[model samples]
Target: MEEMSTILSDLDEIKSALKKSVTKSDLTDIVKSIVKEMLEENKKEMETRVKEIEDVYMRKCGDLQDKIDGLGLEMESLRELNAKKDTAIRNLNATLDDAMRIANEARSRSNYNEQYSRKNNIKIFGLKESNGENVSSEVCKMLKSPAKVELKEEEILAAHRLPSKFTNAPRPVILKVKNTDIKSRVMKQRAQVKSAGIRISHDVTLLNTRLVQRLSNHENVSQVWYYNGSVFAKLVDSDARIKFDITDDVDLKIRKKLRHPST
Candidate 1:
């Protein structure tokens, strides 16, 4: 009976140990707690790492955005500069084109036209006159015609050189009253007047009449007037005498040798 009681005790003890081993709730709870702790730590670490990564990414993105913004500003500046340059180039080309057109038009007009010197310049031309005294009337008739001249800047300076407009006008015209014989002598001299060097002293009135009639025939005579000692005649057919003034030009002097045949 003692041995059987001992064996029953041992079997009871084994059954209790087997029951404790089969119902492992406490161990499972401990393992589950440990896993939960590990999972929480891992989650925190992952969250921190994710936050750090996001910060880094944000910093890089900000820097990239700044770079992009700077590049955009630079591009905008370059575009503006290019636009200004193009505008300036276009304006310059337009100005050049306008200048060229004006130059061409002026050139075309210059071919057929001529420019004359200002007034106060004497022009020399032909005229009809009975004597040296009568050339003034012929010059007066010629002055009615239009004068053509070609003047330059240099010629204007040359006229200042001359002392007088006419060399023969140093003395005034001498007029005297005519006797009855003077009319008869003038009428007789009129027939052979052109060929012979015969000159008859006549009244101032007769001289003036003959001068007026002869000068009216010529077209080129510009002006005729009595100034100093002689009559002056101006011509308009050519650019013979109209020129610029100069300081050292010919002095006004009376020259009797330059007399032409009376017309």
Candidate 2:
């Protein structure tokens, strides 16, 4: 009987131990399932966060691209405006050049016409003057004696004393003849009156007078004179005659003629 009791006790002990082992295994399986569930939840949250970051990055890149496109368009517009301004400036310069050319042509024509009107007039220097004197009669008598040219008072269109800058000297005389032929005859006899301290010249424009004075002062010019309303210059030691006008740059012309005689 004792042996039967001992065997029953051992069996009970074995059954209790098997029940504890089974409980321990069930607890381990439950812990593993809970850990797996937590891992899956964390993975899902991380995926959501990654997706949000990608969306924000794409939006920022799109905004940057739009700004770059806008700047490119603005730059192109500025380039077009600059091109138009450059063209406008060039056109304005061309118009100004044309205006200057037209003005120069008009001035030249006016000077030519003024010189032509005084064709039959003569200027006499070193003529005696009085407070109240008959200038026409004196001119006629002087021409007859010294110049040896006969002139009637009726042939003289006008004779008068011109204003002189020299206060102490006698004023010059301006004589206008009826015809160019009579003027030519008097001019031919001008050398004969040089002994009487008298001088005669054509009535030239003020511009021609200044030009003649300048040419007379030039070192290369030997003689300067006016004939038939035109100015002429003789080069020193050279028989070449140079004809100048009011529009001529005498210095430049002389330099060019000296450099190239053929010109």
Candidate 3:
């Protein structure tokens, strides 16, 4: 390292000394010492600027810390609110489940006699078919309740049984579904519409899609759908009995048609 005062002294002395047979080595040393001093001065100025920047950053850090603390407080508040809401929802769910169980029991009891009557008279028989083949209701019943049953289109016709095809009419399938996706959507829509105080008719394929979508928006809705322009949906079990004109309230537009009678 070049000594600061020595470099200054060398520069002062070199002018007068250079004219008096100064050695080449002495002039080289003086020039190198002056260059080192200039570099050191530049380094000091950079250090002063760095310190100023550090001070400004330290001030900014205080503001950042305040923002972080505020955000933490807001997060805590939201957590507390969420906890309360969860508790309230749990209580409501429990109450709703109890009510639905009672309603299901009542409905089951009302249908008991009809089911009992059918069970008592259900006959299993075996005989030859009209085309001179061995076929019977008992055989058909056995065929219907086959182990590892995979129903095919032909068997339904040969056995004189109704096909399990979904239709908008008063079909046996009750709910018309083409795939699992549609089934899931329907189940969800059913729960939603029922929760909104809508009565489920015998057939659901007569509902309107837009009305069902509106019911799906409710938190309590479990399913919703519209088939042939009628409204049908299911509600969360807990809220099913809560009466409301859901179809009318949701602004569903439906036109009733005259029933046709034919032989």
Candidate 4:
């Protein structure tokens, strides 16, 4: 543009200089030639400018294509990396699940052992107590009378009142018998004793108590009772009497019964 402006200014000066001696026809021809040359130069300059812009645009397009190709490769690599991580995570979760199952099994075994130790025991509540009361004699006498379960005093392995849970009432008596038969007999005759303001239940371990609580929460279960070491349940919806072994996973067993009621 600057060169074209300079050429136009020089032509104007020459026109002024030649105007005094030049005829009209010669001046018109001279000015026409100069205008034609100026137009040719301007067209070449425009073409050159267009070619330069084309070159710059093509280089930028090639650079952008290279960047896009690099991005595609990076994305593919990231996808492969994520796939490997997903497999590793799945394997880790499986291992964790196996470890948890083994741990739970071991804990269940421990709880079973604890509960087994208290299998041949019965707990008697609503019994009066004094400081020097012979717990074994008192328990045997009560069983022989209202409980109607003939139990020898010698069959009583151990006897004691539990630690006082409340000051307003007497503590329940815990009686460990020599065999499970005695405890079963006591539970069998519990209804007769219950009528005389006496409550008889199995001497349960802490683990057994939790199991009983879970069983109690079952919708179909009307009453859950334990005798000796075994668990017995009566369903409200059906006469389907369910029995479970004295295992630590009694809650699991009870829940299984609820899920498959026919079983």
Q: Taking the tens digit of each residue's C-alpha lDDT, what string does model 3 give over 1-263?
A: 46998888898888877677778888899999999999899889899999999989988998999999999999999999999999999998998998887776665454443333322121112221244433334333332343222323333223231233534322121222234343343333433344443322322211233345567786655666443323455555532322222225442221111111110
* Backbone clash numbers for all candidates listed: 28, 0, 27, 0
lDDT winner between candidates 1 and 4:
4
lDDT, each prediction: 0.44, 0.88, 0.46, 0.82
Q: Model 1 RMSD to the real structure?
A: 21.9
Instruction: Say which prediction, candidate 1 or candidate 2, comes out ahead on lDDT.
Output: 2
Per-residue CA lDDT of candidate 1, range 104-141, in tens? 56743342132111112232322223444443333223
Residue 185, candidate 4: alpha-carbon lDDT: 76
Quick one: best TM-score, which candidate? 4
Count of clashing pairs, candidate 4: 0
The digit string of per-residue lDDT tens for model 4 on 1-263 reads: 99999999999999988886688988799999999999999999999999999999999999999999999999999999999999999999999999888887776678667778988878888988888999998887887788677888899889998988699998999889988776777788989999888898877777667667777897757898765455678877767777654344555765777689887
Q: Is candidate 1 or candidate 3 better by lDDT?
A: 3
Q: Which pairs in model 4 have colliding backbones?
A: none
- Backbone clashes in candidate 2 total 0
